[model samples]
Target: MKTRIATAVLAAALLTACARDPQPASLPPAPSATSTATSTAVAEPCASVITRMSERERLAQLLVVGVDPADPDAAVRLVREQQVGGVFIGGNATALLRNNALDAVQHAARWGVSIAVDEEGGRVQRIDELDGTLPSARTMARTKTVDQVRAAGRERGAQLRARGVTVDFAPSLDVSSQPDDGPIGDRSFSSDPAVVRAYGLAFAAGLRDAGITPVFKHFPGHGHAEGDSHAGQVTTPALASLRTVDLVPYQDVAGFDGGAVMVGHLTVPGLTDGVPASLSPAAYRLLREDYHFTGPVLTDDLGAMKAITGTYRLPDAVLHALLAGADQALWSSGGNVSAVLDRLQQAVDSGELPATRVTDALGRILPAKHACG
Candidate 1:
């Protein structure tokens, strides 16, 4: 009886650890970078494998290009040709989600490709048409207990994983009270940072339970931004004001395992100078240094968002995002795979973007991937 109790206690402890540290037991750590791998077993020693990859492959691994949901062949071709890290399955289309199209894309990669989606639920979900509905963050907070919210996330996550999704960009960590339909409005769990932290972590844990990596988004906080980056450049409150409220939920994520962060395009008065957070070195520095977040840092959409397009083209935006310290740059409009790779190669050849940075990005990326292939 004592042995049975001890065994149960140990199993519970390990499961708790698995949620915070996703690295598989069999994989070797990436050179000079910490491993952020999922707890699921993987066939390859991916971290060690990344060190031997080509310079261009290393750079390619830093991008998560968009894939049209209606067309699956394009995604497979893109990864086969460019050896890019992952493909973003965005928008409301259900064609790709309906079949095993993603499996073909996954097998096309020599390494592996991460299949990511924005499944935050309610106004922002990718698979609800086929799987079922999920309440918005506000509704989840107001109507359900934290445990219920976690269960909902787990159920939705399992559904997405079944559809070949490996990463979910969800559970907005922003603290806000804006109108329900505004940019962050109901997407945010609550205006209270503490509530955001509790509900956000609960949702994240649920996804982790289902073997889907949960990405805590709009880092440094997007809840209080003055405008929507989807339409135009947005600015946030000064760094000091952010530190108390908007930035509070982030404090819990630095140590969270099997997770990632999405940096928004908002410009902060005291931190970003005049650049959006997605393109600012200072903003990344704060996330890396001040917050001590070591997981994969991804840039929010740079292709369609006006804040990025208004200032730079796709190629230049990708370059800027890399130099700004993002592990991967997401462009969800779904084209320009070859053109963008060519541009990034040119930047590397000219020493505009250092080779070491590419390798460092790969170190974080390889370990963080859910290995859909």
Candidate 2:
């Protein structure tokens, strides 16, 4: 009986040892140092890719041309030929169209291109058919709390990101003092600069949290402007007025890290001798010097916007935008993209547009691309 007890005890000890030894399936293997290093090595290519890009390729990286969702083939062609840095999904963007366009563009380009959309919620939203609409900017400002606005931004960003969109041209910081203002009426968050500043920051933060980039629009204040830039040149209030009211929100968000600002087409007579801010060196100077914004500065659409096209053709307007310190010259109509590329390359070759300008633009752009990725 003692011998039998000893054998039973030994069996129990064996059972305990088995229980102490965890099954392989229960514990995930820790990543080895070599594997971790390999994963990091894979991500280092974008830097080298940027370094090896030719001058023309570098210039192309500054262009974010629009693409019609109906014409996916054309977008593919544009990516293959023009080597544009990004494509903004334009015109009635349904889920199918957005997915198709993304697939085509992503397949064509050797490097990934930033696929962006105007999903600013409310009336400015471009992909509402695929992603349901949120309240207008004015409505949200009047009714929604800062947290509510931020949550809306996250929802908007998730919808876009789900369809492979990376950038959101949104959260207009223009403070609409005049509710009846023709261009920015319903689009502006509030007449109060503080409200606008708070909501804008919240909305931007939400987009960043969702892994999407947000671009603040109509810099130096389009809220006070008289007319729509798409129709014709609009004029903003004097610089003093802008400083007090219009420029306040921008100054508040100027230090934003992962955000970009879109210079408007308004003719700021006070700051820039009646030059549209998008093409005016003085306007850009105010943003860069006074506001201390070092992030990417994009121009409002250069294509067919009477504010620019009325004065300069597509190619010339692109050149002016680049010369004026705009990083990405957006043509939202999907015009002859190759022609614009050819013209930019020619300008670079002729020394009309300095290569340093391209490099400077890339300095702002590539980091944003890497961040979004």
Best by lDDT: 1
Mark the regions of model 1 whose C-alpha exceeds 4 Å error after superposition. Answer: 1-47, 370-373
> What is the C-alpha lDDT profile of model 2 across 45-139, one tens digit per residue?
45566677887788889899876565667778888887888887655535335544577677777666778776665556666666577777788
Model 2 regions more than 4 Å off:
1-47, 93-101, 178-181, 371-373
lDDT of 2 at 30: 17
Q: Each model's C-alpha lDDT? A: 0.78, 0.73
Clashes counted in candidate 2 amount to 0
TM-score of each prediction: 0.86, 0.84
lDDT string for model 1 (78-106, tens) is 88988888888776667778777788888
lDDT of candidate 2 at residue 362, scale 0 to 100: 74
